[model samples]
Each structure stands twice: as C-alpha cells, then as structure tokens.
Target chain A: MQLTERHRKYWRANLRLTGTLLAIWFAVTFGVVWFARELADIKFLNFPLPFWVGAQGALIVYVLLVRHYARRMNELDEEYGVAEDGR
Target chain B: MSRAFANRIKKYYSFYTGAFVMFVLALAVAEYMGMPDQWIGWTFMAATVALYAGIGIVSRTADVTEYYVAGRRVPAIFNGMATGADWMSAASFIGMAGTLYAKGYDGLAFVMGWTGGYVLVALLLAPYLRKFGQFTIPDFMGARYGGHTARTIAVAGTILASFTYVTAQIYGVGIITSRFLGITFEIGVFVGLAGLLVCSFLGGMRAVTWTQVAQYIILIIAYLMPVVFMSYQVTSMPVPQLVYGTVLEKVTEREEEIMADPAQATARDAYRARAEEIGRAIAALEASGSNGESLAQLRRDKETAEAKARPIHHHAEPFPGETEAERDTARLNFIALTFCLMVGTASLPHVLIRFYTTPSVREARESVFWSLFFIFLLYFTAPAYAVFAKYEVYTNLIGSSIVELPGWVASWAKLGLVKVEDINGDGILQLAELTLNPDVIVLATPEIAGLPYVVAGLVAAGGLAAALSTADGLLLTIANALSHDVYYQMIDRQASTTRRLAVSKGLLLLVALIAAYVASLKPDTILSMVAWAFSIAAACFFPALVLGIFWQRATREGAIAGMLVGLGVTLFYLVGVKFYGMTKWLGITDVSAGIFGIPAGFVTIWLVSLFTPAPDRATLELVERVRYPSLRG
Candidate 1:
C-alpha cells in the first residue's frame, strides 16, 4: 500500500480536477432544471441550454470523466513504476 | 477424497436439498387447496418461510461471512446462478414480456437496456470494485476518501438507491398476488412480506445465496414453459426462437383477414385516422408549448380527441408505418433509457456484491458470460412471446363468449381476474381494453393460451422464485450496509465478528419490516420502478465509481461532491417529473429526464476531482491496487 512520489503528484491533480467538474455538474443540473422556464431562452447546438445541458451534456461528461480518470491513473501508475498487474 | 472435502460437499447438498424439497411439498399442498392461484401462491410462499425458519433453528454459526457474502467461497458457476437469480427477478421474467406485449417495438428498449447495462458493469466497474475488497460500497468510499464525510455521502446515496429499488420489488409482489392467486392487494402484500421475512432471517448470506440459486432454476423454468407452450401452439414449432417468425406471419395474416372484411376495415381505418390526427395535434402542442395558453389549447384538443375516440380503442401502430416523428422520439427515449440502465447496473450494490461471492476473478468473468448466455436464452424468446400473446389476445380473447374466451382466461376471469369491456359496444373485447400491468402477461399467459392449471401452478412457483431470489439478494445488501458500512465503520470499529453477525441479523429483521411496508404501496409496473432506480444509480454512483477506479488523484472531497451532485440531480429530476409537476417548468417531457441527469453526474465527478486536494500517495496505491485484480490474495 506504499505510495511513490509520482503517485502523490498524480492524486493531487486528480482531486483538484474532480472538484471543478463536480461544481459544474451541480450548477448545470440545479440551475438549468429547477430554473428551466427562465433558461429556455439559452441554446446550444439549437437545443435549449437547459435541455442540452441536462440531457446530452450529462452523458457526454460521464464518458469524458471516465477517459480523463483512466488516462491520469495510467500516467501516475507508470511514473511510480507500479506494475500493471499490481492494479 | 479428503474427509474435510467430502464433509463440505455433503453439508452443502444437505442444506440445499433439504430446503428445496420442503419448498416443493409445500407448493403441492398449496395447489391442492384449489384456492385461487393467488391464494395458492401464499401456500407455497408460506412453505419457504417455514423451511428457512427450520434451517435457522438447526444451524449453529450463521457465520458472519455466510450471512454477508455467503462465506465468499462460492464457485463461479454457482455464484453466477445466484447472481442470475438476483438480477432476473419478476421484473425481468414477467414484467418485460408483458411490456413487449403491450407496447410492441417500443418495449424492446427494456430488454436492450437491461442486457446492455451489464456490459458496462463487466468492463467498467466490477473487477475494480471487487479488487477494492470491501463488504459494501461505503467501505470503498470511506477508505478512498480518507474521511467519515465521504462515507456519509456514499451511505446516503446507497440508501436512497437501494430503498427505491426495494420498494419496486415489494410493489411487484403485491401485484402478482392480487392478479393470480385470488387475494386482495393487501393480502398479497402480507404474503410477500411473510416470505421475505423468513428468507431474510435465515442464516443471512448463506441461506440467501443457496436459496437464490434454487430460485434461479424455478424462475427460468417458469419464464420459459409458457413461452415454449405458446410457441408450440402458434407455430407448431416447439422452440421459442423459431416461433417469432411464425407469430409475425400470424399477425400479418390477421391484419389481412381484418382488411378483407370491408366493414371491419372501414371501422379500423376510421379509428386509425382519428388516432393519427390526435397524435399530430399532440406533436404540434409539444412543438409550440411556449405558454399557458398554448398548453391549455393543447389540452382542449386532447379532450376533443379523447371524446371522439372514446368508444374506439387504438391497437399498436404498425411496426413499419411509424412516422419519422414517432421514430425520433422513440430513439431518443431508447438511448436515454439504455444509458441510464447501463450505468445503473454497474453501480447496483446488491448485484455488484454478488460478484464478490465467486472464488476468483476469472470465475467472476466466466459467471457473467454464463449469466448472459442463460439470459439470452429467454431474452431472444421474449419477443416471440410478446407477438404471440398479442396475436392470441386479438384473435381469441375478444368477441368470444366468456366460456369460449380461451379456457384459462375464462377460468381466471371467473375468479374476478381479467375484465374486458366492449368500449365501442361492439360486443367483443378489443386489444385496447387490456390493462398494461406487464407482469400480467406472463402470469396470465398460461390461462390466456388455454393451458392447464398445472401449468398455472408451475408459473406461480416461477414467480415466487423470481421474487424470493431478488428479495434474498436485496435483503443481504441491506444487512451488509447496516453492519459493515453503518455500524462497523461508524458506531464501533472494534466490534467482534460475532457482534457484527448479531447486528446484521437485527438489521435484516428491521429491513424486512420496512420492505413489507413499502411493498404495500403497490406501484404499477415492476419495470418502471426498476428504470427509476437505474437512472438514479447512473446519476449518482456510476460516475464516482468509474472515476475512482481510473483516477489515482481522485480526492475524497471530489468523490463526495460528485456523488452528492449526481444523486441530488437525479432525485430532483425523478421526484419532480415522476411524482410532482416539474416537467412543465423545464419544458422537458418525462421520457427525457435522464438525458439531463446522467451527464451531470459525470461532469460533477470529473470537475470536482480537479478542484479538491488530492488523496495522499497511500490512497493512490490503494486505487492502483483496485485498478488491477491479479494481485489479490
């Protein structure tokens, strides 16, 4: 369960990025969905901003989150010389 | 053979066989009462209760691991059987077929969504979660986040998700009892409750796992027999897969028959045209729903259409003739639902925990493959069942005298079971009069197709298997969360194994009571409630789990924040649209809510991870350990 210096750096960046993404998630979900009536005026790719962000945007974010986390983990694991089999 | 090895196998079979035989005998006695099938259902259920109680009286340890993870020594094949039993409940076995029956192609979404969800779990979540090596989800959350705060959020999410899912299962039990066995809805709730209590109280995971394996066999048999019978009757082909083409041909022939009769054709055409007009008006209203006035106008138009079509009920839209608008709406809804289901399956605690029951990682993978293979056997045949059931309803159930309406329908309806109204005064029941309780299609199938009461009895047994297996799994998860996550983590970390076992049993008893109360609420379709659970899971845990597995830097703060946001958004959307009047505020239809919630979860996890202080190297190493399974001792 020992951690290397590279692993420490990787976690530092990962944690910070997670916070930023979460804030955006909350702002979009509550603001757009709860206040959708007022926000319908906004549009993304011709979709109402509320509609676009709530539905399509959330799914896209899920995929991106997986990819980002996967890549970051790989980079950190490599830097620490942790064998692939260790995970 | 080693004495210990022989002793182990002997003990396992003795326990399993003894319980099963007791169940069968009880089922026989129940069938003998000639009580309505629903009442007879209780008889068999009561037997399971007695059998489990009997086991509790005899067994010594009711060991901790046995209670929670079935000793965590179940072979992959056996564990797979138990998992299949857990996953394919009354909802999948009974509800899905009925949905396909009622909705046509649109219903295919449930099957696709369900099967496809597991792919996400196998690839994205299972192996990692397994390697994390915890009793419950909160174990991982608490350890990874390195704080009680993170565990609290994860706990809350698990409770919300599990409670919602369990409520649906309870509701399904109530429904099946009322419809099949001649019982009041409340009576059905009690029957289901009694069965859950007995199964849950027995030796915990040990009892539940073995019971689930048995239930899997019963449910699969129950699910398939009627399907096989229907296929044989409709196509003269005994296998379900080959029968699909035959059923389609029959429907086509029926359409031609109706069309050739000018009088019938005219009536059908008028009904079809009126329905199309109403559909177009509804679309226009959706397109221009900019204000209250437009909404009111749309409502008025809808009222007019309802009045005109009041006597005439519309059959399903022709599979090929669906309009571009209809297809677009269906496709969008399909994707949204499928995505939610996939994510939800990946995060479902009970299902995930079952994977830990297997002895090895390779076994877990093989178990999933087996589950899918076993599942596809029925899944591929389900569409055929739907088509044939529809055909039978249209061709035989309507217009015939009560005595003549398929012997089983008459038999069942006599018990005040199915009541069809001739809304148009046509003196014949139309397909529209059929109530859409998808579970009914499977339960009523034997009776619908003129099968015997013996077949009916077998189906009832099957339904019980489905219900009990799922109840066993869900109850165990509830118990583990209470003992491992809530109590061990939060209350007293120094508690002994015996103490934990005692607390878990007590928790199981408490959950049984709560589950009974929830089951009494009696929701409409098992499938709908299941979908709601999936959407919530996708919105909450899926993003966090996926991110945590891959992102070494995912700090406890970001994980907690992501779960809270994802869960909050999903709950808001579900409660607002499903129960309350929030859909109007958002100008979003109920069908598209997940389109908004799922991505919100993902973004929250990823974005939150970036801003929070990262976990220390120790936590990252744990993450690295979870990311790979081979190193597990």
Candidate 2:
C-alpha cells in the first residue's frame, strides 16, 4: 500500500468535503422535522415542504454523497498507485 | 448419453428443477389433504428444516469464514438470491401490505424508502465494505477508526439495532403460530423458536444462506398469489393501490347509506333500543350544563349507536366523534406512522448487508433495479388485497343473521385464525366490522377473496418463507459479531478459524434464544418497532459510514463523537419523548419530529474530525486498497 503526496492532498480534500456535507445533512433532518409546520407551507415541485424534505430531499442527498464518495475514492486510488481493481 | 451432455443435463435438472418440483409437490399435497391454510404454513417450516439438514450433509468446513461468509466465494447470482431472501423478511411480506391497507397513499414512502436504501448500499457502502470486509459491521468500524473503543461502540450499536429488529420477527412468528396452529401465543413463540433454531443454529451461515434463498422464493410467491387472485377478481386491475382506492369508494358509500338509514332500519331493534337508553343518558348529562362529562358520555353513546345502526358490517373506522381535534389526531397519527415506515426502511442493517453479495459495483446497481421490479410485483397488489378483505368484511360478515359464517369464514374461524364478534347484536356477520390486525391483512387474503383452499394454504406458506429467511440472515450477522468480531478480532486475534466457527455456531443458538425470549415479551407494533430500529441506525451508522467512505481525514475521535451524539439524540427522541413527554425533555410538541439527533450526529462527527489530526499516510493507502478490489487481499 504505497501512499504519495498526491494521495495525501486528495484524502484531505475528501475529508473536508464529507464533513461539510454531513453537517448540512444533519441540519436538514433535524431542522425540517422540528419546524415541520412552518416548512409544510413551502413546497418543492408540488410536494409539501416536510414531505419534500422527508421523501425527496433526503434521497437526493444520499445519491450525491454516494457519487461524491465514489469519485473521490477513485481519485485517491489513482494517486496512491493502487489500481481500481486492487490488483 | 455422452458424458459431457449427461453432466449438463443433470446440472439444470438436479438442483433447480428438483427443488422447484419438491416445493410444488409439498404444496399440492398439503392443499389436497384439506389441512387448511394454517397447516400449510408447516410446509415452509418443514422445508427450512429439511434444507438445513441437507446442507449439514454436504459441507464440513471448520473454517470460521466458511461458516460466517461461506468462505467469501459465493457466486454473485447465488449471493443475490440469498440477499433477496435476506432482505424480504416477514415485515416486508406480511406487515407491509397491511400497513398500506390501513394507511393508504402515505404508505408509498415505505416501499420507496426501503428500495431506495439499496441504492445507498450499492454505490456508497457495499463495494468498499466488501473490499475491507472481515466479518461484522463492528470490524469495519474498528479498522477504520483504529481502536478497540470504536469497535466496542460499533458492536454495542449493532447489537442494539439487530436485537430490537430481530425481536419483531420473533413476535411475527408467534402471531402467525397462534393463528395457524390453534395454539396459545406462548406456544406460537416456542414453535417459531424451534424452527429458527433448526434453520440457523444447526447449519450456521453455510446452511442458512441456501435455506434463506429457498425461503425467499416461497415467501414471495406466497405473498403474490393472494394479491394477484384478489386483484383479478376486483376491478380486473392487477395494481394493489388502485384496488384499495376503488374499494375505499365502495366502503365510503356503504357507510353513508348506513348512517342515513339508521332511523328507518328494522333490524337491530334490540341493540338500537339499548343504544337509545345510552343516548338518552348522555342527553340528560348534556342538559345539566356538564359539557366536558356530557361530551365523553355522548362519544360513548355515539359508538354504541353506530354499532347498532351498522349491524350489517364489521370493520368500520371510528365515526367522526365529538371533537374535531380527536379526528384530526387520528389522521395525524396515521400520517406519522407512514412517515416513520418510509424513513426507517433506509436504515435497516440486514437489508444493507445484501448489497455486499454482488460481485461488482455495476452489478449491485443493476440488482437493485431487479429487486424493485420483483418487489413491485407484490407491492402493487398489496393494497388491493387489503381493500378487498376490508370490503369482504363490510359486505358479507357484519350484521347478517347467520350464527355460522360462510364456509371459508367458518373454516378460518375454526382454525381460530380469523376471529369474529357480533359487535352490534344484529345476528349478521359484517366482515368489515371486525377490528383486524394490520399484520393479518396479507395473511388473511385467501380467506377474504374466497380463493381455493390451496390458495389460502399458499398464503400461509408465504408468511413462513418471509419470516424464516429474515431470521436466518439476522442470526448469521449476530453470530459473526460474537465469533469473528468480538471473540477472534478483539479478544483473541490468534484464534484458529475452526475455534472461531465453533463460537459463531454457539452465538447463533444463544441469540435465537434471546430473540425468542424478547418476542414472547411482546412489543407495541412490528412496524413501529422496525422504525425505531431504523431511526437509531440512521442516527448512528449512516453518518459515520458516509463520512468514512468520502473523507480521508476522518479522525477516530470525530467518528466516535458523531456516532455517540447521533445515537443519543435518536434515543432521546424515540424513547425519552415517549416516556417523559416531549415538553419536559426537548420542548418540542410534535413527536414525529426527529428533533436534533440527525444533525447533532453530523455536526459532532465533522467538528471532532476537524479538530483531530488526519489518518497517517499508511492508513490512507489502506483506504485506497479497499476502494479497488483487484488491489490484492
């Protein structure tokens, strides 16, 4: 398992981005749930505010996080001299 | 025949076709004997036991990995089948339909959330975890965080989540048993335990996986048959929700007529006279300027009056009572339960584990599409059966003057599986008038639709399939945590695989006992309990897992902080709010509000990770190694 300077930078960036996104994730879940009534007045694409957050918003974030992680991990693999196949 | 040709012929015929034939034959024989649907449930219980016995004769590996993960060489297709079996437990097959039946449109959240959780597993968690995989969820936590503390916390969380979830499955078994076997609830639990022990403990993972795959097929077919038959009968539409909604229109009309015709109804004079007595007593209270007490009395009288007037039906929803607020509360609770179900589906562990079975990341992605396709087959039919059953109750069984029900009803009632009571004393059975358990909606489908005896038998077989498959998968995970993660990795790193396998088998037995014990204690509801488990998982694992995969600088301290805070918040909202009241604990009025737990976890993880130093270059390389499977084990 060889690690180069490029790997270090990529890893650092990945960590920072993950941390930021996660913080936002928490805010969305707790904030919207606590203020469901207030948010329910707001709608996205015709869904009630709370319903949008609960059903659609949470799912979209999950997809973004997954794509973000997969791409970052692939980049880190390239820098570290480890092939994507782990050969 | 040529040797090569014979082998090819034998391969397809022997394994796949033979098993299919045996299952069909068993089903046919059970149906033929007039053994009833409840007795048909035994076919699954028998098949699972028989499958385990066969696995024991074929495999003799003493290696722990062999027992825990089948030496990690399971073919992708076989693994997918097993995973399907693992994912579609009793809750999915039995409880889901009933919920949709009772809740209506709001229940889509459950189906969507559950299937969507697989997407998270495929792209985000599974491949990487498989790359880094050793045994248990705690193993990943311990390795990523680099410590015994992280591992210990992960293990505790897994146990908490797994144990709570498994208890619900056990409770399901008990309910099914009491319904099918003419047995006491205690005996039902015991019967469920005995079957689980044979399917899981006797064979360990090696046996459990294969058996689970079989169970999945049985359960899925069982779940589908009744819904399909019912859908065909009503509206000729195969879609479940449409059938349910269509029946809703019919039921609403009947209810309206009953409400209007109460004044001129000739039947139920006895109950109507009693209701008048109660109604007058309440009217006197209202005349005395006692609004609060008078309202309570009036509400009770209303129930009595509705019962008398609607003596021809059984399962009526409570009428619009005195207070608008109370009616709104019922509607609100229905909405909240639906929300909990949808969100919680994304957080289940056993379901998450299924994605790991796929060989490539792409395959994982495709498999989910297949799963959703397979799931939709029954999912669309569920509401149909639910509504059809409700309509059956309303139309025929409610207030009819027949002391004995029609053949199917009498038969099911004789099994004590579907009980009835003459609530309004009209001597007629109103099927809709019965207070049906949500769990029984799918289970009771064959009887409700007046399907052939064999169809009813098939329905029972399906419930058993769903229950046992899920039980086996959960038991295997629990066993791995004890044997591979705790005993081998943490306590004794140098322990031989053979010794570890022994411990894993022992743990399987112990956990099965514990689950059986917990199931006997009985919880509030299977669906709600499942939600509690999921919310706890989302609070604890989802954040940590997401962060671990994407963030290279995620510190041990940060991960730990995030998990603790998230779990604490989820628990406070779930248990604390229930016991202490939301006002005293968090000053929040709505219990459906998950409060601050999810965000609290995310923040704690991020801030703590930032404050701590990043992983060393060596650990970063390990992360790289795990990301790519061809990088070498």
Candidate 3:
C-alpha cells in the first residue's frame, strides 16, 4: 500500500483538468450575471446577451462543462491505467 | 449486473415507457369523449402512484447491499435519471417555471446554481465518494474522519435537512393534489405520503432509485409537453429555446404598452390609496395600544393587501429596481444564493447517496453528466415556458373586453386563484385588472393555451412524480440515518441484517407520517423553507466532506468542530434574521446565510486540524485511495 509516482501524476492531471474547467465555470457563472446589463446592449441576432445567458446559455454551458469533464476524466483514467470497470 | 441483466432492464423500461405513453393517450381520448375532468385528475393520481408502488414491490430486497446501495451496480444512464429525479424536488419541477415567470432574470440563480452544482459533483465529490464506496454519506464521515462522533453529527444533520426538505415536498403535494383531485389539503398530504412510503419503504435505496428514474421520465415529459405545445401554438415553432428570443421581445413590447395605459395608472393609484389607508389604520392601532384582537384583524388585512400586490417590474428587467443601490443588493444576493445552492447540492445526503448506487467511480462521473443532461431538459425550457406563458397572456388575454375573457379565467377566478376586475370601469382588461399568482402559470398553461383538460391532468401527474420521487429519496435518507447510523452503528453493532432492514422500513414510515402532519399544518412558503434547508446542508457537510477527501489531516475532532461551527453560524444568522428582527449583516440576506457558515466551517477545520494531532496512517491511506483511483493497496 505504498504511494507511487504514477498515482501522484494521475492525481495531478485530474486536478489540472478540474482547475481549468472550473476557472471557465467561474467566469461564465458570475460574468454573465455581473455584466448582464452591459451584455444586454451587445445583442447577437437581436436576443439580449443578458436575457439569453441567464435564461438558456448558462445552462447549455453547464451541460457542456460536465460532459467535457466526464469525457476527459475517463480518458485520463484510461491513460493512467486507473480506469474502473467501465459500467 | 451482467450484460444480460442490463439488457433485460432496458427492455423492461422500454415497454414501460410505451405503456405509460399509451395510458396517457387513452386518458386524452377519454377526455375528448366527454369524460369528466375530476375523473381524469383522480385517475392520474391513482395510476401514477400505483405505478411507483408496483415498482417498489417488484424491486423489494432483503439483502443489505441491495437495501443500501442497490448492490452498487446501477448503470450510468439509469443512475443519471434517478439523480435528476432525486435532484428535482417539487420546487424544481413545479416552482421553478413559476419563479422564472415571477422573478424574471433573477430566477436564473436557482437554475444556474442547481445545474452548476453538478459540476462540483463531477469534478470534486462524486467520483471520489464512489471510489470510497459507501452506502451513505455518514459512512464516509465515520470511516475517513475516524469516529462515531463525526458519524453521529453527520447523521443528525442529514436527518434534519432531509426532514425539512421532505416536508416541503409533501406540502407541495398538498397544494398540487388538492388542487387537482378536489380533496382537502389535509387529505392531500397523506395521499402524497402514501405515494412516498410505497416507493421507499419496501426496498430502501433500491426502490427509491428505480422509482426516481421512472418519475424523472414522467416529470420531464409533463413539464415539456405543455410548454412545447404553447411555443408552437404561439410561434409555429416547437423548439421553445430557439423561439424564446422572439417571444421575449414581443413580451417586452407588450409590457411597455401596458405600462403606458392610463387605466393602468388609475389602477396603481387605487392600490396606493388602499395601502395608505391600511398604514393609517395600523398607526392608529399602535397609538391606542392595540389589543391582540385588533392586531390579529389588522394582520389579516395586511395579508390580504400583500396578496393583492401586483408585479411592478417587467419580466425583462434586470432586477428588482433601476437604482444602482438596489441593483448592487440584487447582484450580491444572487451570487450568495447561487454559491450556497451549489455547495448544498454537493453536500445533501440524499443527492450524495445517489453516487453510491453506481457500480464504480467511472459510472459515478458518467452519471453526473447524464443527470445534468436530463435535468437540462427541464431547466433549459423553464425560462422559455415563462416567456411564452407571458406571451399567451399579453397577446390573447390583456386589453380584451371583459365580456370576452376565457372560461379558464372565470374558473380560476371562482377559485380565488386569479383576480380580474375592471377597476377603472373601462370594461376592458388592463394588466392591473388581472392579478395572477405566479404559481398558476405552469399549472394553468394547458388551459390557457386552449389545450384540453387532459394535458392539465398530465401536468398534475408530472408534478406529483417530482414531489414523490424527491420525497422518497429524502425519506430513505432520514430513515437510513436513524436505523443504520444511530441504531446499528451505535446501539446494536451486531444487529441482524434483516432486523436493520425492518427498522429502516419502519422508520421510513414513521418519518413519512410525521412529515405529512407537518405538511398538513401548511408552513409558510415552500421555497423559503427549502432554501433554509439548503443553507444548513451547505454549511454543515460541505466543508467536512470536501476536506475529509483532500486533507487526510482532518481529524475527527476537526470534522466535529467544523460541523458545529458551520451549523452554529447558519442557525444563528437564520434565526436572528428570520425571527429576531436582526438587521442583515453586510446585506447577506437570510436565504444565503450559508455563505457565512461555509467560510467559518472551512477556516475552523483548517485551524483545528493543524492544532490537533494528524489523522493516523490508515486514514491517510484511505485518502490516497479516494484521490487516485488506481492507488489500491
């Protein structure tokens, strides 16, 4: 039950992936809301940025974030030989 | 667990979905053939609850593994659907669109926070907990932090938060059931309890998990159908999300036009005069040293006046006010509330337990993705639902002659749920002439869209599924905490597995009944009570659980200190601000009290763990296993 460099490497990779994704998550969550009034005037196709982001865009981003994490982590686990029995 | 078994499950569910759809269509036919709306309502209530109960009976198990975590072999997609159902309470299913309809842009905090929370789950908590492999959240607390004290405290917090949350669900059922079934609220709550008990009592987590998957399907379909129909009805496009912008623009224009109507101003003045009259009466009562009787009368009057209050802000408005001070306050409250909800989503015992049902850490991660996708089906549609329902009102109902108002309005008015009057005696409906309770928008959408009564019945059934699924998970969490954590772990370590199962079932029933009684009492505001539960969960468990995974140095003492500090600050602020009239500190509203408690808990855990002795070698090894899935001893 000794710790190995391999374990540390895998953990580090996982952490890095999580960090990058979360930084984007943090920006999308608060940024859309904070600059909502400003974003509203800068519309794409006549839909106000604030309204679209608050209503729908942020949720779509959430789905994408989790999808990316799940995909990347499984691949990371595979590369590190740490993958569980894929159920 | 095998490929054959998984295929069998897929087949069974496919057949079940087909049958359920056929059943609904038959009901629609019955409605078209002059079947009574009462019969449709009763049929939906009976059939859906019975369907869930039957699944519970079929999935009933005596094996401890099955009882606790469904033998830990549930596939990713099914687990995701179960988690979606588990995550969406009556609040998300029933209240969310209504909230969006009322609060407008501000309501996205609930949507964003709840969905964004799953990101925390997938990235931080879910896979590790599955790697740890336990039946309940407290199991991790006891094993990782290493003591009964931590486990017991975890159990206490789990029960309290789950119980509070479950009562809100049942209370919601009381409203939905009584409204649909024509039963009294008291009877409606017990009916909801019956639905909950039959699902969770028989097979514990196994029953609840499968039933939740079924419930998720019902709820998502129920939520989307009316909304999609309305969107298509209004815009000739079936996709609500795509059509949302156009509908929103139209709604904004209507809001501006309605705001400019002189009759609307007359209505506003009448409301102002009424408010002034009440203020004067209250002042006079206080001057004369008001008696309890007079005070009670005034309180009732105030309540009436408050309910009469109409929306002053437009749906597209950024927040509550145009002033910078108010905008600043709204934004802060929004951010705080979102953070608390995200943490709470990660920490709730019922939600965390869903991860344990997956076969492995990989399934846990996959299931989270699926959960968000499934939940997004409803979340992405809610704002669109709000705007289109608004469109229906703006285009069809408002500015119409009073004599031409629809039958739905007359019926809703008869129930006192909607108020429409020609206050200015113009014989035309102004926006002010209609005071619609936000709750009615989702429920009334089918009829408002000129759909048949059958769709309304379907929506009611979907709402029931949402409440029942969430209630079942919560009830199981509470019962398991008592029977597994308290009784077996503490009182009788060598208790037989059958005995533990029996106790869990009995406690589940007892807890269901108690929650039913509380719901019968009809607490003020399900959303507020639910928010309170979330803050407590966030403060109490979020710090301890996250730290225990990452910081092997988190001793039992540190965990205990963290929980107490977190719970203490949350309850203190909540009680003081909610009950004692304490001015909110830093304008941190009462709902986001956990924003304070979370920081306090994290700081306390860090300081206490450093000050105390480090956890032993075995605990450190356990942390390694959770952190790196490959690092098996």
C-alpha positional error of residue B470 in candidate 1 after TM-score superposition, expressed in Å: 1.2
Better of 1 and 3 by TM-score: 3
iRMS per model, in Å, is 11.7, 8.1, 1.7
Between candidates 2 and 3, the lDDT winner:
3
lDDT of 3 by residue, B46-149 (tens): 99999999999999999999999998988889999999999898888777888888788889888888888888888889999998997788889889887699
Residue B200 of candidate 3: its Cα lDDT?
83
- Candidate achieving the largest DockQ: 3
Query: Highest TM-score: which candidate?
Result: 3
TM-score of chain A of 2: 0.68
Higher-DockQ candidate of 2 and 3: 3
Comparing to the true complex, what docking class would candidate 3 get? medium
TM-score of chain A of 3: 0.90
Candidate 1's residue-wise lDDT over B1-633, tens digit each? 234543675577567756655655565565666646555555655554565555444432456666676666676556767778888777777777777776654465555555555555555565566666567777777888787887777777666667756766666677666665667888887777777666667567667776676677666766787778887777677886554654555665675555454444434445456666767877776787666666667567556434433332122232222465654444455556555665677778888887776554544555555555555555666666777777887687644553355555654556554655443455554444433345567777887666656566667767766776787678778778878888988899899988888898888878877877766765444335556776666666777777777767777777777777777777777777777766433344454455577677678767877887778888877877775433322
lDDT of 2 by residue, B348-457 (tens): 55655555544454344444445444544555455456567766665665555556666666655565545665654556654333445666677667767766666655
Q: Model 2, which residues run further than 4 Å from truth?
A: A1-87, B1-44, B56-60, B236-347, B360-362, B368-372, B394-433, B521-530, B584-595, B628-633
